[model samples]
Target chain A: MAKMNMLQAINSALAIAMEENENACVFGEDVGAFGGVFRATSGLQEKFGKDRVFNTPLVEQGILGFANGLAAQGTLAIPEIQFADYIFPAFDQIVNETAKFRFRSGNEFNVGNLVIRTPYGGGIHGGLYHSQSPEAYFAHTPGLKLVFPRNAYQAKGLLAASLESNDPVIFFEPKRLYRASVGDVPEGKYTIPLGKAEIVQQGTDITLLAWGAQVEMLEKAAEMASKDGISCEIIDLRTVAPWDVETVSQSVIKTGRLVVSQEAPLTGGFASEIAATIQDECFLHLESPIERVCGLDTPYPLAHEKEYMADHLKVYEAIKRSINY
Target chain B: MAKLLNVDNPNNTSKNDTLNLEFVDEHALAIPTFKMLDDNGELYKDAQASSMDKETAIRIYETMRFIRVFDERMLAAQRQGRVSFYMQCLGEEAAVTGSAAALEDKDMIFAQYREQAALAYRGFTLEQFMHQNFSNEKDFGKGRQMPIHYGSKGLNYSTISSPLGTQIPQAAGYAYGQKLKGDKACTICYFGEGAASEGDFHAGLNMAAVHSAPTLFFARNNGYAISTPASEQFKGDGIAVRAVGYGMKALRVDGVDVLAVYEAVKKAREFAVENNAPVLIESIAYRLAAHSSSDDPTGYREKEEEETFRANCPIERFRRYMLKQGWLDEAEDEAAKEKIKADVLSALKVAEKVAKPALEEIVTDVYEDVPLHLQKQYEQLKQHILKYPEAYPATASRIEETK
Candidate 1:
């Protein structure tokens, strides 16, 4: 085991996957000699050769369409979209063609081997253009599987699992935690199932649910709540689409209170989906209404980003409200 | 500065250095339109050097004839209320069939909806075609797609999608995979002059050129994209000129001449496979029929133009060329058409009568294994369908059997 950041974990996972499977390839803008803007793919091209790791034109639609073509021909394509905020150019290709290939062809053909990797969410002062969470857009799509990893360990494991899956996956790596959240990750190959959750702490007063960077925020909030004589159970949802609803619901049933947090806008965010599902499954067990600490319904601003983000204080407030109620 | 200055030639006072400026005429880049066969069904004297074998020529002619027959019969069937929609390749048969005939069976084809002739040339049987159009259980696409959206894994034809130009970039990526495999196979993407307007067209071509993927982009410039004619589509020369901008080889062929299209595509396949490069071919043809059974060309075009194109029909031109080579006879051609019509009619009758796909098929294939959510949704749908059996007799009867 080695202490690594999320970027290092992801790069190691990609290298391992490529070494294991000859059909696996990596391509995107600046992913070759430049090794990606964030260096997530720093030494991949030199290690795997230019044939396996290469750079594509700065066109998201073309990048995804080419990936679909490669996947359709039985090649494992791991295409990076640079940033999740800039994925709209290729949305149609991902939504209509890649997602529907198997269903439309009646199982005669499929591009299920392709995985789209991109960094998402805010906290790096990227402002509106670079910092946005668009997971709900893909979660609404039926054929796609959405995965969000909280830290280095989960990033490596869940990414390995996504690459091994037989369905197309949209993997969102929290850009804020790429270097900030470091952990001891295993060197060899490992896989975490797509819909599993990890319980960070065991408590009974209230359950704090979050994913990606919000998990870190909730961790801090849980510590503060513990000092205030209120115990908070924390569940970090590693996968977003086919989330581990059973885990969250079971926790909510015991705690009888829930506080969900995310960095995306309040309306129509994935947090709403979790909140609604929990309420439906554990309505009678609830002692207080589920509270949400989320980004306001506005574009991520440059100067007032702290105000727009769901910081630990917001989570602490939600935890206090849930416990007091 | 006090004197009047010539705006055409700016006066420089600093250094007496001369800067050469020359005017280049746009006409220097003339787009050539290639034609091998004349209107009278005779090969041009200069075009007699084509190296086409007798068997290949005859197969090309036969495939063209089969597509013509299939299109006519299917259009009539649509009018007769047997099928919901149909798109005919009335005048552009030579473009699709000739290009497809030139490629090996292993070479992939990513075609638009109207390139049914390409599928037929690749050995898609009449029964398979009918099953797809009829949306029967036997259809390869499982009745999920609309009529004529054909796909066959065995034949290497990518499933056709309704969205224009989507297959272009996909073809590039597939060709890249073939290149990596060190296989001599290439991918041919078929689209229209109108589909060339989509942003995917630029993206696909640019990607193919940048990656050195072995992809042949065949643009059937058949004048119209639905009701919109080519004149209103773009002011540029054609789709072929755009290849130069992408640093790729391109050719413009007379789509009416099967031998020319065949020769061009054959050479293009060689160039792409040998160099792992992409080539673009713009085949100029005219749409002799409506865009589909639902359209009426008279509203947008003149009858005289239709008559003119009909006179130079690709089938008749190819048949005359074959007759000159003593490879075809008038009586044999007539008999072939009659047999194809009979076979297509029989296939349609049998396929349309086949059972609708099982209701459970709707929820299947969404994933490798149906997840719990989809299974629950399917169960709910089954309950709803069973409650109204009379309204959905075909679906209701198949629900229990699928389970």
Candidate 2:
């Protein structure tokens, strides 16, 4: 094991992917000599040469369109959108083309070998355009697999797994943890299983569910809730699309109460999906109504950054409300 | 629009390096269409020779003949309620088949929905065509895509997607992959003048030029994009001169002349691979048939206009050219067309009779493996079908027998 941050972990995984597979290519806007804005792709062009690791013109739709073509031509293409907010430009290519290529062709051709990487979520002083969680939009697409990593170790493992899978994936990295979050990640190749949730801490009073950077906040909330004598089971949902329904359902059944949280808005956040699915599975368990702690429906405001966040304090309060009811 | 793939001002051909800014006249630039063959299949004076030989010429003509047969019979089938829908490459045949003939079989092809002749040129048989249009069990696409959305792995043709210009940028990426691998092959992207209005067209061409990737862009300027005319599509001198803004090579050719298209693409293919750059070719033709079986051109265009285009039919032009060259036998040509029509009808009858794909196909290929929720849903659907056998008679019996 070696000490690495989230960006380092991702860089290591990309190096391994290029080394192991001769057909794999990495390209996006400013991904060449400059690496990425977050340095997630640092030193890739130097190590792999400019041909395999390159920069594309500044067009999100073009990047995905090119990636789809490359992947269909039997290359493992990893194209990065500079930011999650900018990914909206390529929505058609991702939603209509990349998502449907395999199914439409009946496996004759697929962009299944492509993985799109983009940094998401808030905490940086990045105003409207940079700080937004758009996972909820892509989650609605059926053919795609959305994978988000919480920290250094998970980042390396989940990225490796995504590269190895035979389906197109959207790997949303939490930019907030790019450097702040550090851990001892394995030096060589390793993969975490897709669509499985990890139980960070087991408890009986309530279940705290979240993915990506929100998992870290849930852990902090669980710690705060422990002081109040209410034990919380914290489940980090690694893969968000075909999520670990069994794991979440089992936890909700044992705890008899659930609190879902996310960085997106309360109405249409992925938390609503979790709540609806879990309620169906654990309806017989005697508990209060499920609670969702999330950002407000309004656009993420600049001056109201702190108030806009559904951080640990809000999650802790939700836990207390669930336990008392 | 301040978007990535912004529309270019057609009149702004030259860079305004000087200080004063006066809007240039769009009419100042007149792009001459490169024509070699006339309506009588006779070459113009001082025209250059085509690189096509006698043998390859016959194969291309045959593919065009087959597509004409396929389009006619399929449209008839749709009228008879035997098929759901159909689209024809009717007047644009020579443009598609000629380019397909020019490329190496290994080069990947990304096409819009109407280039069925390209697939036929790449050896897509009559049976495969029938299976896809009929959406039967034998269809390689498994009835997922609509009719005319054909794809073939063995033939190296990208599956046809309905969304316009989506394949343009993809062709750039695929060609870049080939360039990196030191492969001599390149990728060709085909779209119509109507699709050029899509942002993807600008995005795709810009990327291909910027990266210096070897991609051939084939634009069939077939006079109309459904009811919308080329005049409404763009105000430029066709789609060819737009390549100049992107620092790429381009050609505007008479699309009805099969030999001219063959020669232009052959030269463009060399430039793309040799220089590792992009090239665009605009083939000027006319849409002889309605956009699809669903469209009726009576309201949009007059019969006189259709008659004008039909007078210089793509297949007839090529047939006349071959007869003039003494390369085709009159009796053999007549007999071959008769046999082709019979073969297409036989294949259509057999493909339609084939059963629909197994019910499980509804959910099988969405992912590598069906997830737990999907599996449960599939099981529940079976139970519901069994409980209401009368309502879903076809699938209920199949599920019962399979269980």
Candidate 3:
């Protein structure tokens, strides 16, 4: 095991996937020489050669469309959108073509091996253009799996699993945690199966559910709640679409309260889905209405970014509200 | 007089080299449309002839006739309410069939919705086409897709999508894969001139050129996108000139002439595979049918204009070429048409009577294996459908079947 940041883990995962499978390749704008804007693909082009890891024309639709074609041809394609904010240009490719390829073709054809990686969420002060968390947009798409890893350890494992998956995965790496969050990730290959939530902390007072960078915030909030003699269970939902509702429901059934936190806007976010599902599954056991600590519905702001973002304070307040109720 | 900023600095001055500047008149930049045969079935003098053999010429002529017959029969079926929707490759047969004929079996085809002629040329059977259109249990796509959106893994034809221009960039990537494999194979992407207005067109071509992907971007400038005419689509010198901006080779062919389209595409394919580069071929054809069964030509077009294009019908032009070559006889052509029409009708009759897909298929193939959530959703849907048998009689009836 080695201590690594999310960027390093992602780069290692790409390299490992490419080393294992000759059909695997990576492409995006500035992914080659520049090693990606976040350097998540640093040393990849040099190590894998330009053919296996190369730059593409700066068009998100083309990048994703090409990835679909590559995957359809039995090549494992890892195409990156520079940021989640720019992925909308390729939304049609994901929704209409990539997502529908297998279902529409009746299993005769599919871009199953395509993995689209993009940095998402706020905290980098990237203003509106760079910091928008659009995981909810893709989480709504059925055929596409949405994965967001909180730190290096989870990022590497989930990414490897996504690369090996026989389905298109929209792997959103929380840009806020790219370098900020570090952990002891295994130097060798490991995989964390999608749709499995990891309970990072154990508590019976209330359950705190989150994914991506919000998991860290929730962990901090859980610590704060513990100081107030309020025990909080933290469940990091690695995969948003096929989330481990059983784990969450079980946790909620034990705790009798739920506090879902995410960096995305409260409306139509993946957190809302979790909150709704928990309520349906464990309604009678609930001690309080499901609380959601999320970003404001407005665009990610430049000025007073902290106020616009959901931090530990907001999550702590939601925890208190749930515990009090 | 206004003084030029930084005029005293010689380095800041603009270079005035009019002598070296060569100007191309806008008219000169207009693509030269190619034609191998005239409307009267006469070969144009000094025109380049197709290298196609007599057998191939006869095959192309028959395929065109088969498509025309198929379209006529299917359109009649659609009107009869036997099929939900249909899109015909009426006058644009040469644009699809000829180009498909020119390609090797290994080459991939990424087609727009109207290229049924290409599928037909690639040995997609009448039964297959009928099953897909009828969306029967035997339909390869399992009734998930609409009519005319056909695909076959064996045929190497990517399934067609209703969204315009999505396949254009996909061809580039598939060809890039072929280039990586160092295979002699390439990919041919078909779309209409109107689809060229999409951003994907620019991105696909630019990527193909930059990556030196072995892809042939075949644009059938078939007059209209639904009710919108090509004249209203762009002011440039058609879709062919746009290829030059991407630094790719391009050709504009007379789409009514099968030999011309075949020759152009054959050469384009060779160049693509040989140089590992992309080539664009713009076939200027007319939509001789309504955009689809959902459209009515009278809403936006004139019968006189349709008749003018009908005079230069691609299938007729190819038939005339075959007749001149003595590869086709009038009696044999009529017999072929009758046989195809009969076959299409028979297949339609059989396909329509076929049962709908298994109700379980509604949840299957969403993934390799249906996850638990989908299983639960399917179970709930089954219960709901069973509860309201009158509203979902077809589904309720099939709920008990093991298949």
How much does each candidate deviate from the true structure in C-alpha RMSD?
A: 21.4, 20.5, 20.4
Residue A188 of candidate 3: its Cα lDDT? 94
lDDT of 3 by residue, A152-267 (tens): 99999999999999999999999888888888989999999998999999998999999888898998989988899999999999999878888999999999999998888777
List where candidate 1 sits over 4 angstroms from the true fold.
Answer: A1-325, B1-18, B22-27, B401-403
Instruction: For residues B152-252, write the lDDT of model 3, one tens digit per residue.
Output: 99999998766668789999999999999988999999999877876789889999999999999999998777655666567789899988888889999
Residue B399 local lDDT, model 2: 76
Q: Per-residue lDDT tens digits of candidate 1, residues A15-98?
A: 999999987999986577557767888798889898989766545787899999999999999999878987887899999998
Clashes in model 1: which pairs? none
Candidate 2: the clashing residue pairs are none
Per-residue lDDT tens digits of candidate 2, residues B1-403?
A: 4664525655545555778787877866666788788778888888888779999999998999889988999999999988867899999999999999999998899999889999999999899999988777788877655677789999999987665677999999999999999998899999988777667888899999989889999999988766556764567888888987798899888889998999999999999999999999999999999988866776467999999889989889999999999988889998998999899889988988887666576556657787665565456456655765674544566777778
TM-score of decoy 1: 0.57
Chain A TM-score of each model, in the order shown? 0.98, 0.99, 0.98
**Between 1 and 3, whose TM-score is larger?**
3
Give the DockQ (2 decimals) of all models: 0.01, 0.01, 0.02
The C-alpha stretches of model 3 lying farther than 4 A from their native spots are A1-325, B1-28
lDDT of 3 at A153: 92
Give the local distance difference test score of model 1: 0.86
Candidate 2 residues A75-183, lDDT tens each? 9999998789778768999999999999999889888899999999987644345578998998899899999899999999999999998999999999989999999
